[model samples]
Target: MEAGLTERSDEKGEEEYVLLDLDAVMEHVSIRPDTPYVLTGLDTLNPMLIIDGKVKLIGEYEETIGTCLVFSENEAPVLHKETGPSDANLFSGRCIVDPNQVPSKEVKPVARLQKVLKFRLLLDGVDDAQQDHPSTEGNASNQSTATQN
Candidate 1:
Protein backbone atom coordinates (compact mmCIF):
# COMPACT_ATOMS: atom_id res chain seq x y z
CA MET A 1 0.00 0.00 0.00
CA GLU A 2 1.09 3.60 -0.76
CA ALA A 3 -0.31 6.95 0.35
CA GLY A 4 0.58 10.58 -0.31
CA LEU A 5 -0.97 14.03 -0.26
CA THR A 6 -0.64 17.09 -2.47
CA GLU A 7 -0.85 20.71 -1.44
CA ARG A 8 -1.61 23.76 -3.55
CA SER A 9 -1.92 27.46 -2.89
CA ASP A 10 -4.91 29.55 -3.94
CA GLU A 11 -5.90 33.16 -3.40
CA LYS A 12 -7.60 32.18 -0.10
CA GLY A 13 -5.03 29.78 1.35
CA GLU A 14 -3.24 26.44 0.95
CA GLU A 15 -5.24 23.26 0.43
CA GLU A 16 -4.25 19.59 0.96
CA TYR A 17 -5.52 16.29 -0.48
CA VAL A 18 -4.83 12.61 0.02
CA LEU A 19 -4.54 9.55 -2.24
CA LEU A 20 -4.16 5.85 -1.44
CA ASP A 21 -3.08 2.95 -3.68
CA LEU A 22 -2.96 -0.79 -2.99
CA ASP A 23 -1.90 -3.85 -4.99
CA ALA A 24 -2.32 -7.56 -4.22
CA VAL A 25 -1.88 -10.98 -5.82
CA MET A 26 -3.62 -14.29 -4.89
CA GLU A 27 -3.06 -17.70 -6.45
CA HIS A 28 -3.65 -21.45 -5.94
CA VAL A 29 -2.33 -24.32 -8.10
CA SER A 30 -4.10 -27.68 -8.09
CA ILE A 31 -2.12 -30.98 -8.07
CA ARG A 32 -5.14 -33.30 -8.29
CA PRO A 33 -6.87 -34.53 -11.48
CA ASP A 34 -10.52 -33.95 -12.54
CA THR A 35 -11.07 -31.22 -9.90
CA PRO A 36 -11.97 -27.65 -10.88
CA TYR A 37 -12.50 -24.47 -8.87
CA VAL A 38 -14.27 -21.10 -9.03
CA LEU A 39 -13.58 -17.69 -7.58
CA THR A 40 -16.24 -15.41 -6.03
CA GLY A 41 -17.20 -12.85 -3.42
CA LEU A 42 -14.75 -9.94 -3.39
CA ASP A 43 -15.34 -7.22 -0.80
CA THR A 44 -13.83 -4.21 0.97
CA LEU A 45 -14.37 -2.25 4.17
CA ASN A 46 -15.55 1.37 4.34
CA PRO A 47 -12.96 4.07 4.81
CA MET A 48 -12.58 5.47 8.32
CA LEU A 49 -12.73 9.23 8.83
CA ILE A 50 -9.99 11.11 10.67
CA ILE A 51 -10.14 14.75 11.63
CA ASP A 52 -7.26 17.04 12.54
CA GLY A 53 -6.89 20.71 13.43
CA LYS A 54 -9.70 22.90 14.84
CA VAL A 55 -12.74 22.12 12.69
CA LYS A 56 -16.40 21.85 13.70
CA LEU A 57 -19.36 20.26 11.96
CA ILE A 58 -22.63 22.23 11.96
CA GLY A 59 -24.48 19.29 10.30
CA GLU A 60 -24.13 15.60 9.40
CA TYR A 61 -22.99 14.28 6.00
CA GLU A 62 -22.33 10.94 4.25
CA GLU A 63 -19.56 9.92 1.88
CA THR A 64 -19.79 7.37 -0.92
CA ILE A 65 -16.90 4.91 -1.48
CA GLY A 66 -15.63 3.38 -4.72
CA THR A 67 -13.54 0.26 -5.44
CA CYS A 68 -12.11 -1.76 -8.32
CA LEU A 69 -10.61 -5.25 -8.96
CA VAL A 70 -8.28 -6.43 -11.73
CA PHE A 71 -7.30 -9.98 -12.60
CA SER A 72 -4.30 -11.35 -14.55
CA GLU A 73 -5.57 -14.88 -15.09
CA ASN A 74 -9.30 -15.46 -14.42
CA GLU A 75 -9.53 -19.15 -15.36
CA ALA A 76 -7.63 -22.43 -15.08
CA PRO A 77 -7.00 -24.53 -18.17
CA VAL A 78 -5.97 -28.18 -18.64
CA LEU A 79 -2.56 -28.97 -17.16
CA HIS A 80 -1.07 -29.87 -20.54
CA LYS A 81 -2.24 -26.62 -22.12
CA GLU A 82 -1.16 -24.50 -19.13
CA THR A 83 2.31 -23.81 -20.58
CA GLY A 84 3.53 -23.41 -24.12
CA PRO A 85 5.99 -21.55 -26.37
CA SER A 86 3.83 -18.44 -26.03
CA ASP A 87 4.23 -18.62 -22.26
CA ALA A 88 8.00 -18.78 -22.66
CA ASN A 89 7.89 -15.79 -24.95
CA LEU A 90 5.97 -13.80 -22.31
CA PHE A 91 8.61 -14.51 -19.62
CA SER A 92 10.92 -11.57 -18.98
CA GLY A 93 13.69 -13.74 -17.49
CA ARG A 94 14.92 -17.33 -17.25
CA CYS A 95 12.40 -20.10 -16.50
CA ILE A 96 13.18 -23.13 -14.27
CA VAL A 97 11.08 -26.22 -13.51
CA ASP A 98 11.64 -29.67 -12.03
CA PRO A 99 11.41 -32.42 -14.67
CA ASN A 100 10.83 -35.34 -12.27
CA GLN A 101 8.26 -33.77 -9.94
CA VAL A 102 5.40 -36.01 -8.79
CA PRO A 103 1.83 -34.81 -8.27
CA SER A 104 0.42 -35.20 -4.73
CA LYS A 105 -2.84 -37.16 -4.40
CA GLU A 106 -3.88 -35.12 -1.34
CA VAL A 107 -3.85 -31.87 -3.26
CA LYS A 108 -7.27 -30.25 -3.69
CA PRO A 109 -8.71 -28.29 -6.64
CA VAL A 110 -7.87 -24.60 -6.84
CA ALA A 111 -10.98 -22.39 -6.59
CA ARG A 112 -9.46 -18.93 -6.99
CA LEU A 113 -6.56 -17.16 -8.65
CA GLN A 114 -6.72 -13.41 -8.74
CA LYS A 115 -4.86 -10.10 -8.82
CA VAL A 116 -6.37 -6.98 -7.26
CA LEU A 117 -5.29 -3.38 -7.87
CA LYS A 118 -7.09 -0.60 -6.03
CA PHE A 119 -6.96 3.10 -5.31
CA ARG A 120 -8.93 5.59 -3.16
CA LEU A 121 -9.00 9.34 -3.73
CA LEU A 122 -10.49 11.78 -1.25
CA LEU A 123 -12.38 14.52 -3.04
CA ASP A 124 -10.85 17.98 -3.03
CA GLY A 125 -12.06 20.84 -0.78
CA VAL A 126 -14.47 18.64 1.24
CA ASP A 127 -13.78 20.70 4.37
CA ASP A 128 -13.92 24.08 2.72
CA ALA A 129 -17.65 24.42 3.34
CA GLN A 130 -17.26 23.44 6.99
CA GLN A 131 -14.65 26.11 7.48
CA ASP A 132 -17.35 28.72 6.99
CA HIS A 133 -19.37 27.40 9.98
CA PRO A 134 -18.77 28.58 13.54
CA SER A 135 -16.71 26.21 15.72
CA THR A 136 -18.57 24.42 18.49
CA GLU A 137 -17.37 25.92 21.76
CA GLY A 138 -17.98 22.74 23.79
CA ASN A 139 -16.88 20.21 21.16
CA ALA A 140 -13.73 19.25 23.05
CA SER A 141 -15.66 18.60 26.28
CA ASN A 142 -18.35 16.65 24.45
CA GLN A 143 -15.79 14.42 22.70
CA SER A 144 -14.26 13.48 26.07
CA THR A 145 -17.61 12.15 27.34
CA ALA A 146 -18.31 9.84 24.33
CA THR A 147 -17.81 6.27 25.57
CA GLN A 148 -15.86 3.62 23.69
CA ASN A 149 -18.37 0.78 23.65
Candidate 2:
Protein backbone atom coordinates (compact mmCIF):
# COMPACT_ATOMS: atom_id res chain seq x y z
CA MET A 1 0.00 0.00 0.00
CA GLU A 2 1.14 3.50 -0.71
CA ALA A 3 1.03 6.44 1.67
CA GLY A 4 -0.81 9.68 1.00
CA LEU A 5 -1.26 13.02 2.73
CA THR A 6 -4.45 14.92 3.59
CA GLU A 7 -5.63 17.83 5.70
CA ARG A 8 -7.66 17.41 8.91
CA SER A 9 -9.00 19.51 11.76
CA ASP A 10 -6.91 19.86 14.87
CA GLU A 11 -7.87 18.86 18.42
CA LYS A 12 -9.93 22.00 19.02
CA GLY A 13 -11.19 21.94 15.44
CA GLU A 14 -9.54 25.32 15.09
CA GLU A 15 -6.74 24.41 12.68
CA GLU A 16 -6.06 21.92 9.91
CA TYR A 17 -3.21 19.39 9.94
CA VAL A 18 -1.74 16.72 7.72
CA LEU A 19 -3.10 13.18 7.98
CA LEU A 20 -1.00 10.07 7.39
CA ASP A 21 -2.22 7.07 5.47
CA LEU A 22 -2.84 4.33 8.05
CA ASP A 23 -4.70 1.86 5.86
CA ALA A 24 -1.62 1.75 3.73
CA VAL A 25 0.52 1.15 6.76
CA MET A 26 -1.73 -1.73 7.91
CA GLU A 27 -1.64 -3.22 4.45
CA HIS A 28 2.15 -3.06 4.41
CA VAL A 29 2.60 -4.40 7.95
CA SER A 30 1.17 -7.34 9.90
CA ILE A 31 -1.03 -6.44 12.88
CA ARG A 32 -1.69 -8.82 15.76
CA PRO A 33 -3.25 -8.37 19.20
CA ASP A 34 -1.02 -7.36 22.09
CA THR A 35 2.06 -6.73 19.97
CA PRO A 36 4.43 -3.77 20.20
CA TYR A 37 6.14 -2.24 17.17
CA VAL A 38 8.39 0.67 16.22
CA LEU A 39 7.15 2.94 13.40
CA THR A 40 9.93 5.27 12.30
CA GLY A 41 10.17 8.36 10.06
CA LEU A 42 6.69 9.77 10.73
CA ASP A 43 5.80 13.45 10.66
CA THR A 44 6.15 14.33 14.33
CA LEU A 45 3.89 17.41 14.24
CA ASN A 46 1.16 15.76 12.18
CA PRO A 47 1.72 12.19 13.37
CA MET A 48 -1.78 10.99 12.65
CA LEU A 49 -3.27 7.87 11.06
CA ILE A 50 -6.03 7.78 8.47
CA ILE A 51 -8.85 5.24 8.74
CA ASP A 52 -11.73 5.15 6.29
CA GLY A 53 -10.61 8.61 5.23
CA LYS A 54 -10.87 9.91 8.80
CA VAL A 55 -7.83 11.33 10.54
CA LYS A 56 -6.79 10.13 14.00
CA LEU A 57 -3.72 11.17 15.94
CA ILE A 58 -1.69 8.10 16.91
CA GLY A 59 0.25 9.95 19.58
CA GLU A 60 2.97 12.49 20.14
CA TYR A 61 6.47 11.42 19.07
CA GLU A 62 9.88 12.93 19.54
CA GLU A 63 12.19 11.56 16.85
CA THR A 64 9.70 9.69 14.64
CA ILE A 65 9.96 6.39 16.57
CA GLY A 66 6.68 5.47 18.23
CA THR A 67 5.82 2.27 20.11
CA CYS A 68 2.53 0.94 18.73
CA LEU A 69 0.17 -1.85 19.73
CA VAL A 70 -1.89 -3.73 17.18
CA PHE A 71 -5.18 -5.24 18.27
CA SER A 72 -7.47 -7.55 16.35
CA GLU A 73 -11.08 -6.59 15.61
CA ASN A 74 -12.31 -9.53 17.64
CA GLU A 75 -10.42 -8.42 20.75
CA ALA A 76 -12.49 -5.35 21.48
CA PRO A 77 -13.92 -6.64 24.75
CA VAL A 78 -10.52 -7.47 26.19
CA LEU A 79 -8.71 -4.43 24.78
CA HIS A 80 -8.09 -3.08 28.26
CA LYS A 81 -5.07 -5.35 28.56
CA GLU A 82 -3.42 -3.46 25.74
CA THR A 83 -4.78 0.06 26.30
CA GLY A 84 -5.92 1.89 29.38
CA PRO A 85 -9.52 2.81 30.30
CA SER A 86 -10.47 4.74 27.21
CA ASP A 87 -13.78 3.83 25.65
CA ALA A 88 -13.35 6.58 23.11
CA ASN A 89 -10.81 4.89 20.86
CA LEU A 90 -10.58 4.06 17.20
CA PHE A 91 -11.36 0.45 16.32
CA SER A 92 -10.80 -1.51 13.08
CA GLY A 93 -7.60 -3.42 13.90
CA ARG A 94 -6.31 -0.89 16.41
CA CYS A 95 -2.68 0.29 16.23
CA ILE A 96 -1.71 2.34 19.28
CA VAL A 97 1.42 4.43 18.63
CA ASP A 98 3.30 5.32 21.80
CA PRO A 99 4.37 8.93 22.37
CA ASN A 100 8.14 8.59 22.22
CA GLN A 101 9.70 9.40 18.84
CA VAL A 102 10.76 13.04 19.24
CA PRO A 103 11.88 14.93 16.21
CA SER A 104 15.42 16.34 16.11
CA LYS A 105 14.27 19.56 14.44
CA GLU A 106 11.12 21.63 14.34
CA VAL A 107 8.13 20.75 12.19
CA LYS A 108 8.48 21.59 8.52
CA PRO A 109 7.19 20.53 5.10
CA VAL A 110 8.94 17.27 4.17
CA ALA A 111 9.55 16.56 0.51
CA ARG A 112 9.25 12.83 1.11
CA LEU A 113 8.90 10.69 4.23
CA GLN A 114 9.52 6.96 4.27
CA LYS A 115 8.66 4.82 7.28
CA VAL A 116 9.57 1.24 8.23
CA LEU A 117 7.15 -0.46 10.61
CA LYS A 118 7.64 -3.90 12.21
CA PHE A 119 4.62 -6.02 13.13
CA ARG A 120 3.98 -9.54 14.52
CA LEU A 121 1.27 -12.13 14.07
CA LEU A 122 -0.81 -13.29 17.05
CA LEU A 123 -2.75 -16.38 15.99
CA ASP A 124 -3.89 -17.41 19.42
CA GLY A 125 -7.50 -18.45 18.74
CA VAL A 126 -7.79 -17.48 15.13
CA ASP A 127 -9.66 -19.90 12.86
CA ASP A 128 -10.37 -19.91 9.15
CA ALA A 129 -14.12 -20.13 8.59
CA GLN A 130 -13.67 -21.54 5.12
CA GLN A 131 -11.40 -24.30 6.39
CA ASP A 132 -13.82 -25.18 9.17
CA HIS A 133 -16.77 -25.57 6.76
CA PRO A 134 -17.46 -28.81 4.90
CA SER A 135 -15.96 -29.44 1.49
CA THR A 136 -18.02 -29.58 -1.75
CA GLU A 137 -18.32 -33.36 -1.63
CA GLY A 138 -19.52 -33.25 1.96
CA ASN A 139 -22.03 -30.55 1.17
CA ALA A 140 -23.39 -32.50 -1.80
CA SER A 141 -23.75 -35.66 0.29
CA ASN A 142 -25.47 -33.76 3.04
CA GLN A 143 -27.91 -32.24 0.54
CA SER A 144 -28.70 -35.68 -0.85
CA THR A 145 -29.29 -37.05 2.62
CA ALA A 146 -31.60 -34.15 3.50
CA THR A 147 -33.64 -34.68 0.28
CA GLN A 148 -33.95 -38.43 0.99
CA ASN A 149 -35.17 -37.74 4.54
Candidate 3:
Protein backbone atom coordinates (compact mmCIF):
# COMPACT_ATOMS: atom_id res chain seq x y z
CA MET A 1 0.00 0.00 0.00
CA GLU A 2 2.75 2.43 -0.87
CA ALA A 3 1.78 5.97 -2.02
CA GLY A 4 0.76 5.77 -5.66
CA LEU A 5 -1.77 6.68 -8.35
CA THR A 6 -4.58 4.30 -9.32
CA GLU A 7 -7.96 3.99 -10.91
CA ARG A 8 -11.15 3.14 -8.94
CA SER A 9 -11.15 -0.39 -7.61
CA ASP A 10 -13.71 -2.96 -8.76
CA GLU A 11 -15.93 -5.40 -6.90
CA LYS A 12 -15.05 -9.05 -6.04
CA GLY A 13 -11.92 -8.00 -4.18
CA GLU A 14 -10.21 -6.92 -7.40
CA GLU A 15 -7.92 -3.89 -7.32
CA GLU A 16 -6.31 -2.85 -10.60
CA TYR A 17 -3.61 -0.19 -10.47
CA VAL A 18 -0.65 1.15 -12.39
CA LEU A 19 2.62 1.41 -10.54
CA LEU A 20 3.36 5.12 -10.47
CA ASP A 21 7.03 4.70 -9.75
CA LEU A 22 8.42 1.61 -11.46
CA ASP A 23 11.72 2.11 -9.67
CA ALA A 24 9.97 1.41 -6.39
CA VAL A 25 8.56 -1.89 -7.60
CA MET A 26 11.12 -3.08 -10.13
CA GLU A 27 11.55 -6.35 -8.30
CA HIS A 28 7.88 -7.25 -8.85
CA VAL A 29 7.02 -5.37 -12.07
CA SER A 30 8.53 -5.65 -15.53
CA ILE A 31 7.91 -2.72 -17.85
CA ARG A 32 9.56 -2.01 -21.17
CA PRO A 33 10.23 1.71 -21.68
CA ASP A 34 9.83 3.44 -25.00
CA THR A 35 12.78 4.53 -27.09
CA PRO A 36 13.19 8.28 -26.73
CA TYR A 37 13.30 10.29 -29.98
CA VAL A 38 16.55 12.11 -29.36
CA LEU A 39 17.70 14.86 -31.75
CA THR A 40 21.32 14.58 -32.86
CA GLY A 41 23.76 17.43 -32.06
CA LEU A 42 21.39 19.43 -29.95
CA ASP A 43 24.39 21.41 -28.71
CA THR A 44 24.95 22.84 -32.18
CA LEU A 45 22.69 25.60 -33.59
CA ASN A 46 20.94 23.48 -36.23
CA PRO A 47 21.48 19.79 -35.52
CA MET A 48 19.49 17.32 -37.58
CA LEU A 49 19.21 15.74 -41.00
CA ILE A 50 16.06 15.48 -43.10
CA ILE A 51 15.85 11.79 -43.79
CA ASP A 52 12.87 10.53 -45.82
CA GLY A 53 11.60 14.10 -46.00
CA LYS A 54 10.88 14.04 -42.28
CA VAL A 55 12.85 14.74 -39.12
CA LYS A 56 11.72 14.19 -35.56
CA LEU A 57 13.26 15.77 -32.50
CA ILE A 58 13.17 15.47 -28.74
CA GLY A 59 13.75 19.12 -28.06
CA GLU A 60 15.05 21.16 -25.16
CA TYR A 61 13.25 24.18 -26.65
CA GLU A 62 10.06 25.21 -28.48
CA GLU A 63 10.55 25.49 -32.24
CA THR A 64 8.77 28.23 -34.18
CA ILE A 65 6.67 27.48 -37.25
CA GLY A 66 8.76 29.54 -39.64
CA THR A 67 12.15 29.37 -37.98
CA CYS A 68 14.61 27.49 -40.16
CA LEU A 69 17.93 25.65 -40.08
CA VAL A 70 20.61 25.59 -42.74
CA PHE A 71 22.60 22.40 -43.33
CA SER A 72 25.71 21.84 -45.41
CA GLU A 73 25.39 19.66 -48.52
CA ASN A 74 26.83 16.59 -46.83
CA GLU A 75 24.58 16.97 -43.82
CA ALA A 76 21.16 16.50 -45.43
CA PRO A 77 19.85 13.54 -47.38
CA VAL A 78 19.03 14.06 -51.03
CA LEU A 79 15.52 15.37 -51.64
CA HIS A 80 13.27 14.74 -54.66
CA LYS A 81 11.34 17.88 -55.55
CA GLU A 82 11.45 21.04 -57.66
CA THR A 83 14.29 22.63 -55.70
CA GLY A 84 14.46 26.39 -55.30
CA PRO A 85 17.80 26.57 -53.50
CA SER A 86 20.72 24.18 -53.26
CA ASP A 87 21.20 22.07 -50.16
CA ALA A 88 24.91 22.73 -50.70
CA ASN A 89 24.61 25.97 -48.76
CA LEU A 90 21.43 24.62 -47.23
CA PHE A 91 19.12 27.55 -47.98
CA SER A 92 17.34 27.23 -44.64
CA GLY A 93 14.87 24.53 -43.71
CA ARG A 94 11.87 25.50 -41.57
CA CYS A 95 11.03 23.72 -38.32
CA ILE A 96 7.83 21.83 -37.59
CA VAL A 97 7.23 20.29 -34.16
CA ASP A 98 4.35 18.30 -32.79
CA PRO A 99 3.50 20.01 -29.52
CA ASN A 100 1.71 16.90 -28.24
CA GLN A 101 5.00 14.99 -28.39
CA VAL A 102 7.00 17.47 -26.32
CA PRO A 103 8.79 16.02 -23.30
CA SER A 104 7.70 17.18 -19.82
CA LYS A 105 11.15 18.57 -18.93
CA GLU A 106 11.73 20.70 -22.05
CA VAL A 107 8.90 23.23 -22.29
CA LYS A 108 10.91 26.23 -21.14
CA PRO A 109 14.00 25.48 -23.21
CA VAL A 110 11.95 25.19 -26.37
CA ALA A 111 10.38 28.57 -25.73
CA ARG A 112 13.79 30.23 -25.36
CA LEU A 113 15.06 28.68 -28.54
CA GLN A 114 12.00 29.89 -30.38
CA LYS A 115 12.96 33.42 -29.41
CA VAL A 116 16.56 33.07 -30.57
CA LEU A 117 15.51 31.50 -33.86
CA LYS A 118 13.54 34.62 -34.74
CA PHE A 119 16.76 36.51 -35.35
CA ARG A 120 17.82 33.88 -37.83
CA LEU A 121 14.68 34.52 -39.86
CA LEU A 122 15.52 38.21 -40.05
CA LEU A 123 19.11 37.54 -41.05
CA ASP A 124 17.99 35.27 -43.87
CA GLY A 125 16.06 38.14 -45.49
CA VAL A 126 12.76 36.39 -44.93
CA ASP A 127 11.52 39.70 -43.64
CA ASP A 128 12.37 41.32 -46.94
CA ALA A 129 10.80 38.51 -48.89
CA GLN A 130 7.51 39.08 -47.16
CA GLN A 131 7.67 42.82 -47.75
CA ASP A 132 8.62 42.52 -51.37
CA HIS A 133 5.87 40.04 -52.10
CA PRO A 134 2.67 41.77 -53.21
CA SER A 135 0.70 38.99 -51.57
CA THR A 136 1.85 40.07 -48.09
CA GLU A 137 1.17 43.73 -48.87
CA GLY A 138 0.25 45.33 -45.54
CA ASN A 139 2.02 43.31 -42.87
CA ALA A 140 4.03 44.16 -39.78
CA SER A 141 7.78 44.23 -39.86
CA ASN A 142 9.25 40.76 -39.98
CA GLN A 143 12.17 41.99 -37.89
CA SER A 144 9.82 42.77 -35.03
CA THR A 145 8.23 39.37 -35.29
CA ALA A 146 11.62 37.66 -35.03
CA THR A 147 12.74 39.85 -32.12
CA GLN A 148 9.49 39.16 -30.28
CA ASN A 149 10.12 35.44 -30.39
Best by TM-score: 2
lDDT of 3 by residue, 37-146 (tens): 22233344433211122222111233445532221122233333434566564435644434555333211111111222111111222222122222211211111111
Candidate 1 TM-score versus the reference: 0.15
The global C-alpha lDDT for each of the candidates, from Candidate 1 onward, is 0.26, 0.29, 0.26
List runs of model 3 lying over 4 Å from the truth: 1-36, 49-149
Stretches of candidate 2 above 4 Å error? 1-21, 38-44, 48-149
Candidate 3 structure, TM-score to reference: 0.15
Clashing pairs in 2: 61-101, 62-101, 62-102, 62-103, 63-101, 63-102, 63-103
Candidate 2 lDDT score at position 86: 60
- Residue range 1-27, candidate 2, lDDT tens digits: 012223234767633222222344465
Candidate of highest lDDT: 2
Candidate 2 achieves a global lDDT of: 0.29
Predicted structure 2, TM vs. truth? 0.16
lDDT of 1 by residue, 14-100 (tens): 542212212110122212322222211112222322123322112212221432221122233222322455644755344544456
Model 1: CA > 4 A from native: 1-124, 143-149
